[model samples]
Target: MPSQITRQITRHVLTIPAQGGKPARKVHYRRCGQGPALLMVHQSPRSSSEYTELMRDWAAHFTCIAPDTPGFGQSDPLPGEPEINDFADAILEFADALGIAPCAAYGFHSGGIILVTAIKRRPQAFRCLAVGGYAIWTPEEMRIFGESYLPEFVPQPYGEHLAWIWSRILEQSWVFPWFDTREEARMSIAHADVEHVARTVSEMLDAGEHYRAGYGAVLRAPRDIPAPDAVVPPCLISAYDGDPLQAHIDRLGAMPASWSAQKVATPKEHQDLSLAFLKEHADTAPCGALPEDGHEGWLELEGGLIHWKGAKGGRLRLHRPAEELADPSKGEIAIDVPGHGQSDDFDDMKRAVEASAEALGVSDIDWPAPPAGDADRLYPDMAPDRFGLYLQRAWQVARAEAFFAPWYEANAAHAVPLTPEAIATPAVHARALARIRAGAAARRWHDTLAQIQGETA
Candidate 1:
């Protein structure tokens, strides 16, 4: 059941111009409400989705805009090894692209580091800032984090990376600096709830090995706080009691007159404090219209927004049942069918596609060829399980699909022409991510495909 708040918020993808020799990239974001612009940045390894409820509440008084920071969610990675400065610059890039004229910003953990750097680089560009936690790590502590934290996350043949990532995130709540299992590192608040752990694990999957760059940048970043007399916008930095960073409030020595730090008793109080601070300082200027490429953008359907790319009247490329939009080079126009990719799930996917086409004025439809004889077997149950097998299952299908027309059939009769690219680690990993992201929605899409083709699902 979708909440009313979820409906009020809308998601979009903006194409940022090429930078530092890198090609143009897509940045996904969530927007809602109608007041002073508030740019919300989430912690590392998590996307804007984590702040859905927070945005909902803040939306009542402010235009909450939270973006999937570069290399985290649907946003593309930076050109190369990005330092704290690169991520900071990326934020300004997003702001300029979206035309949020001097907005108030908020950030948590790694997000806080980036925002701090951004404000220091261009103080006049922001109104104020509300930071959840500000870390002032000592050199010895940074060395320890550098040596033990953020292991290289290379994908494994049997989805071993998936198991490791799930445990890594699950244990993060149990202990600070997850790799430190010692009693001293144990967090005051800890739980192993699968639902919560699953969300972080999925985000880790999206970031892949780039987690090291983002996470490391934060740990290695020096405390960039300015002197009390330095010119800067007003900022409030607060942390909840159980949070590891709550203790770091003491380390923020001699802050500027306009800045203050506090330790709240609970997360609710922490958020309430941040919200109140932002409200006090938030500018009354209007957040400009959301940027959109006239050619490739979201189409608002009755049920939900449909994500489409390329030319509208061009040959419409539909991906496989559980697949997302094909590579842009494959065709002029492609769409992630409802219930797959970034598009929202729908009760009637076939009709949803028709409605999307009608709305886009897309007449030249080019549907995908139905898969060979694979039923629900091709689309397994990918719900979060205690053992984290769903991740491996997606990997299994991804690997098998390369050699056989229907991944379930391994015999020579069903063997397809072998291609090196299909079996490559990166290719298989990409396919597995697509299947994992689709989740049980893949089954619904497969059933819809069967209905369209008049065959068994």
Candidate 2:
């Protein structure tokens, strides 16, 4: 059995310039392992985190690079609702920007479509391609997806969207067109677990409104299979029996000489075959290091990915905040605490804080005193109705004010004000509102957990 030990993954950001003088946009990705390069494109509404297990498994044989495709995950969306070709082009640009070449690629679902299109347009960029599932939607299905499936997901002030999102992800496995309530289309894989629903909902939150662009593009993409006589790179197209795209193997009537399609019995089998195929063709050249985006970004600490926003070389390196949690000076660096802002949380706060400070190149011994007062005083203004939801949103806003505000000021177009109603503060500074919201949500989350534990006890 695999050891199941978590992989040491590092997050990186690369800003790539647009063609024809359009401004450059930031692309975020997670990289792990070594040896031959394998670009992993994730499914819609999820980030590179989806490939954690896969990356760890493949680390022994290859260097796995998974990027959050534009408009989904942490990557910026295209200028507008983009065509599938635009996404394909973005992948090529991403590769060029990173100076990675002679690569093999693997994509799952929508990710697979993007890679397939990328290879179709620029076959030489990759040595081989392996995809989990490739959908060939008919015009009618595309119309339905456009009309109902890919609706713009906006934050509802009352938190009603959360409930809907939870249900949507949970029932997606049970129904073909997730929105369709017809009993005939029900799937055997439908799950009703709350935790599973919550996990996907968190990812949906990360993608926000941009989910439409990525998912929509895939749904609307041209599903052109190469003619038998046409030339293309070596490719393996496989789908598990229950996957909707399994039937697409039939649609791929006259595949290129190098192409092969199969219906696998299980997901493990699909991945095993994919890894074997990619390994067979991998050249294993050492791709150049990822380019650095100057100032304001993430640092992977022992606890989790720490989101820091500031320039290095501050006069006085602030190890942590004092009781008041005051704003950083012109030369100060501020970080969102683990599980606080963009940083992920660890069960042990003290250890996480210590590790985070060290990762940020600050001395752990100089740790500042924590904020004073209890949880209620910290977030006095939060609505009692849905405190947890409000906190999560607020935490993101708080970080934006402290670290991102300066960056945004320099780049005015990137500074989007939090929705007044959603942030629950038309009068407060965006940063203050965020702090209040995070505090409230943290309290609620902890309180709920305690209650559940006590009941079970």
Q: In terms of TM-score, which candidate is strongest?
A: 1
Q: What 10-residue stretch in candidate 2 is worst by lDDT?
A: 316-325
Measured on C-alpha atoms, candidate 2 has an lDDT of 0.69
Spell out the clash pairs found in candidate 2.
174-187, 339-344, 391-437
The prediction achieving the highest lDDT against the true structure is: 1
lDDT of 2 by residue, 1-457 (tens): 2232325677778889767765688898888877777899998877787898899888777778998898776688888768899899999899888877658899999999999899888888988899998888878888888889977677654445555766678778889889998998887667666555555666677677888888888888889876677666789999987787888888777789989999999889999999999888777675556776866577766556766655554432322211112345676666655455456656665566556566656552233432323434333444322223543444444444433333224356545465644345322233433343244334543443344446656
- Look at candidate 1 and give me any clashing residue pairs: none
- How many clashes in each structure? 0, 3
In model 2, what is the error at residue 308, expressed in angstroms?
A: 1.7
Mind giving the per-residue lDDT tens digits that candidate 1 earns over 113-146?
9999999888888899999999988888888888
